[model samples]
Target: MDLDHTGVSADELRRLLRELSGDLLSRRRFVRTYVEMWPTRLSRLVAAIDDDDLDETKVVLLSIRSSSVMLGVTGLAHLATQGLHALERHDLIECRHVRDLLAESGDRACERLLELEATESMLGR
Candidate 1:
């Protein structure tokens, strides 16, 4: 899939995994782990935002952004980065916008990850 249309650099993800791990099984396992934790992370992010906790929000956003970069989840990373910038500027409204975008993108990414899991299973991976 050309995920670039959705602003995701799939090639970067593939390259990073190949460079860092060079093992398909390990990479797949990481993907599964990431998919499993994604929702909980999102919920925590929302809670931090709702509580107006800038410190917590920065921590969570940085974690998510760094992990997303490793996973080649560029859209999520971008959203988190935007949120961080908004937080730095004390723009709560922009932070909310970024949060919404992150949620929407994360949901779609989750669906795609599930599909990838199914395909991998079918391929005996």
Candidate 2:
């Protein structure tokens, strides 16, 4: 999917928000909750990677990918998918490459999410 300069799929976000009845309050609540929990999820991911446990990594990535897709964090979802594919192929090197890319993409996605939250607050969304 084409993403905005923020490296996030704003269109997807807009679509989902519309589906949520355009409820800014709900959106804010959900976003806040996800943001609060993301660090723990990320820590689990790092631990999985450190252990070089492919199964654990795959499980974590799957969870992350699904959550990201639901929340329109396409860059992160895509990176996670790439990692999964690498793992499926048993390409540890490629998996590591995608892991770095996932880290960068996830950082960008989180920054964009914060920016979105700030924009919403500023606009009284």
lDDT of the candidates, in the order given: 0.75, 0.73
- Which candidate achieves the best lDDT against the true structure? 1
lDDT of 1 by residue, 10-90 (tens): 565467556755566676777778788889888888999899999988998998889787876777887888899999999
Among these predicted structures, which one has the highest TM-score?
A: 1
lDDT for each residue of candidate 2 in 7-100, tens digit (9 for 90 to 100)? 5665666666777787777777766766676677677777787789988989888987887887777777887888899889888788777776
With a 3 Å backbone cut-off (N, CA, C), the pairs that clash in candidate 1 are: none
lDDT of 2 at 53: 91
Worst lDDT 10-window in candidate 1: 1-10
Alpha carbon deviation, residue 81, candidate 2 (Å):
0.6
TM-score against native, each model: 0.81, 0.79
